[model samples]
Target: MTDTLLNHHDEGPTTAPPLLLGPSLGTSTALWDKVAPELSVTHRVIRWDLPGHGGSAADLIGPGATVADLARLVLALADSLGIDRFAYAGVSLGGAVGLQLAVHHPERLESLAVICSSAHFNGSKPWEERAETVRREGLAALADTANARWFTPGFTVPGLVEDHRTADPEAYAACCDALAAFDIRERLSSIGAPTLLIAGREDPATPPAHLREIADAVPGASLTEIAGASHLAPAERPEAVLAALRGHFDGYALRGMEVRRQVLGDEHVDRAQARQTPFTARFQDFISRYAWGEIWTDPTLARRERSVITLTALVAHGHYDELAMHVRAARRVGLTPEEIGAVLLQTAVYCGVPAANSAFAVAQRVLAEEDKTEG
Candidate 1:
């Protein structure tokens, strides 16, 4: 028998930001072992078992449960854990839940990363047929075909094969029912969370193009491909997948503390963080989630371009204190003093000399102070 969805295990620091990891169909939380530890370094990682897999038995997902229902179950699991807002990463079926979470509950997600997954899974007949097979004969009925699609030719994961063999038939079939009816291609643009779509070049399951459609629909979403890898890219190309995931999630400040330190100098960020009080807690959360998570982490623009834009906007708006702070960060991010001068000079031509003058003064002083400290 399967345990309730509430039985999902939690990992990483108790104080860290929450991250949910969902597994592919017929797999368990054990699918994430290679990747979870790396993420847990800065996040409270939850390895979620798929319904009817591992400890979560088939009975938990009776008839009428869709991916949306599975998504709701994950949310309920979060609520049970006291995590109001969290980040998510998943593969295939797990990734489908991530998609539903992004589209339906944007406010609840800090960031979303989907690997070897698709917006539509291409067709419903195959899934429906698979669901029927499992219902009639059990998980063994579908393991051979599933195992083939999940890995590259001739390279097998015995553990995952074992996982497929052990999954509860009713639960596996129920999840297939969710996949068969799942189609959100038309609604992809509505997703607001930062998204990373990864695909395997050799994957016959949900090929690169399936992920590409999603990448095109979701604004600012990025697509990465792994050469020579199949459906289970996260398992097949573990290191590459981990690197891409870390960069994507970290950029959003899901581990915002470290990302903030990297972008804004540790001493300055530390001071601001230490200054937080009950009155300013919400404001702090806003900056961490929006500024760091949404804006700074955006993959559409290079960090240097983001810095240039921030410096330019600050100059235009006369946010002098923020201008000063960003001036320091701009330098750390590789904007030279001469380049900074060029921005102010350009600002003077259109934004007017007064705005430019104040920015010029701030940038010069900040840069000079750095020179003195280094000396």
Candidate 2:
């Protein structure tokens, strides 16, 4: 898009928190049409057609532009629009961009939700070759291949594939470059914002394995897998994906507000209420009532137990950052070293040896820290 082509498609009330949505590679913002309406119920949803797709200009940063650069551009767009901070969600290329933003410009985000994206697109040669083909012959050349990875056999009807394959070739190729250069495994630890990682069980491209890697890297990140869906989980199973996003973001929003209140005090929250920035104010109402008042306040589980459950789920699913958060929370909940070890050992069988190995190392470090503090 043009330097100033920050198109804003507002759907909800002005009082709602703005959700900046990034689209997957090879597809325009139209890919979010179904999900956006549901999200708009509580959020002022803003979807963008990245450079070279939809009405946005093509290749504004040229062919060599990395996904990080695209992230910077999106942040710039938010800045220009007076959005000091906002929640973000993305799929595929969009998810990669969201990852970069969460790591690099964390202060500019309240929460992040990534779907069908990986921190590292490793262990696959076919994807690389297909990316190369798109970079040369264009997206149409790999239409069949892309369809196979994006949707399940049943969902890959002729009409659906054709619709997905209609993306702009140049934009799709640029996205391929972004994907090829994307790798944020090491930087995931630096992401401070709460995050949700969603994967399609049937996603052949960025499969559950890749999603596990992302969850493992980003501290305290949550993961949810949608059964019987493909790479286009948001589209193929919009309800499941939307519910996950809504629930996770809602919880984050509530918890963050509560924490802010505790740390900053009620006077601060009241002052914030009076002079709240557009970005902060919009999320306060919905997040406080729904996220904190409803979900977080549920009496069925103690926060301590909930923390352990959340962490255990992440560990079992190979979400490292989330596991780390839970590890820290475990200490807070008075879980002994032996108990933490037991959790990791149990997770090893369910999540796999390699993941369990990493979890053990993290648990050991966290426990060592606890010992030092107690000393």
Candidate 3:
């Protein structure tokens, strides 16, 4: 059974959070080639091939296969890799499988991103017809239309087209059978995982409306539409797709925490974390994701400049405790005691004498503590 699991490519550190990338019906792991490496920097990215699409055995799925069947195969692959729960992002049929996991196997999923997919694929007629066509004449005819169906006009990835051309006709038809039967709209509201929908603005197969429908139904789900892309957005517009997936996976939290540690020092952050209670956890997350992640991590202003501004703001608000913290942060960002004094003196002129007076007292105490430790 381990050998019978879907073929997959794994990247990134084994200790990092697991993220699985699923491919469209006729595509394979190659579909994520452009984006997975970058995502792997912060996540353990594992992209898999559909049965017979890439390296997997053609018999892994059969003619009457359902999206739920595919979801189970995905779980088998994760289990083989020692992963119990994972974030998932998939395109088209792949996305449908992700939805199946979120709805049924919620405990195995951390989050989901459904790209160029729908809860229900229009209806069964078109897919049924396509499946029959492939069973009779093979994938050549459909493969010829891959570029037009998958991307905007004049944009073609030859490798993807080749993947479509080479897919096992029986397996491709079975996948179509899965799509034809897939309709999870009634259960959309029950999905509890954090969900994101990425739609290709130019996709003719599963248009932005399809993604929007999922967004509207799934609680707390968000939608993003990518211009100049079609069904295979990750292949056609990888950078945009990468950005959306990264944001959905909370890449900001990882980047933000690194910045927070640098600005506040490990001792301060660790101490604050030690004191964090369940009641204050959400507020702490906000500070990390918003204050440190988005604003402080912005490169427009250097850390030193931000420290100065933060100090002034704290003085203006008469927040002595926060001011004391920033005064220490100021030194970490390379502000000399003299520079700190200069900024506080300017604050006295503008923020008022009393506010600056209080700020100085706090800064003096922090500096004295640091001197004692250093000496």
Candidate 4:
């Protein structure tokens, strides 16, 4: 293990907006090679290998390690790099980690985008069994099985197949453990950051049903499913994945900037810019233009209404970090705490009581903070 923290391999201008990327299970940062260049045109991209996978050290937290550990590690990586906040885009296990981060560390994320992922991975027994096999045998044993879910039948490329085959076996097993234990289905509604959920229509591993479950659980979560792609949507259908991420970040960045200006005022924005450190400056323009500009200026809905809708959606879907932010935004938009509670209670019936139960806890904390600030 390298004592030094992981560093991002940058493609474009160092000053562009930063996007920290998490790769799929069992693969290295190279998984993003084809997609990162296109995204790098406008954003500074960071692609890193997960611990015990790729170029990173081979120490596992054992089968007992939770997905939250991955989330915390990623966050630690960001902190080590001096990133206060940045956009996050993840695939499968990576996406699940992103969701957890958005819920638990809202202040550290500007936006989140998940592709070919699910909020829960509990019911898939065969998949778990196969993973255990890889843990014992190696990745080669599951080559055919992994390939089928990763790419569409008609579009198979020999090179891509080889890439999948050569992946680290222990890393793959570790990821399987991460996925098997993942059960954030009940907590999707509490994520407060703007989110984009992309799925492959033909994906068998994480079917469209699971995607719908995620969308429905996270309030205001926008979903787009690629018709021909399967589980490895990023690799099999890079163009679609790139376009969705670009559009999402563009929209989210715009909305966030507008809100910052409104709340912090123009002078504050300017003063913040004047005093901006290199680390913080990387995200300033991108956040202002995209998150605040596009999302905030859209005439389709008012900020307050959007806030309420977003909060309701997250609560219904179970994304707590984003849920917390929107709850705060709901207050800023004039929604009463009671109204927010109503949304959670209503979501309980539609999304389930477990989700609602967790959402209510986040709501209470958010409301309490608001009350303290006012008092």
Ranking by lDDT: 3, 1, 4, 2
* Number of the top-ranking candidate, with TM-score as the measure: 3
lDDT: which candidate is best? 3
lDDT for every model?
0.85, 0.75, 0.93, 0.76
**For every model shown, what is its TM-score relative to the native structure?**
0.69, 0.65, 0.73, 0.65
Runs in model 3 deviating more than 4 A are 251-255, 258-366, 369-375
Give the Cα-based TM-score of candidate 2 against the true structure: 0.65
lDDT of 2 by residue, 1-375 (tens): 245564446577665677988877666666787789978877778888777666666655556568887887788777766688899999988898999988888888999999998886763354556556766776665676767778888675454456446756665666666677778888998898989999999888789888888888788988899999898887789889988988876654666567545433466467758976778755676656555555556679876676567666887777776576568766665677787788778777777888889889888887788689789
Off-target runs (Cα >4 Å) in candidate 1 are 1-3, 252-375
The residue pairs in collision within model 1 are 2-57, 3-55, 253-256
**What's the lDDT for residue 193 in model 2?**
90
Model 4 vs truth, CA RMSD? 18.6
- Total backbone clashes of model 3? 0
Q: Whole-model lDDT, candidate 1?
A: 0.85
Better of 1 and 3 by lDDT: 3
Candidate 3: tens digits of C-alpha lDDT, residues 202-321: 999998898999999999999999999999999999999998997899766778889999999999999999999999976787688668987899899999999999999999999898
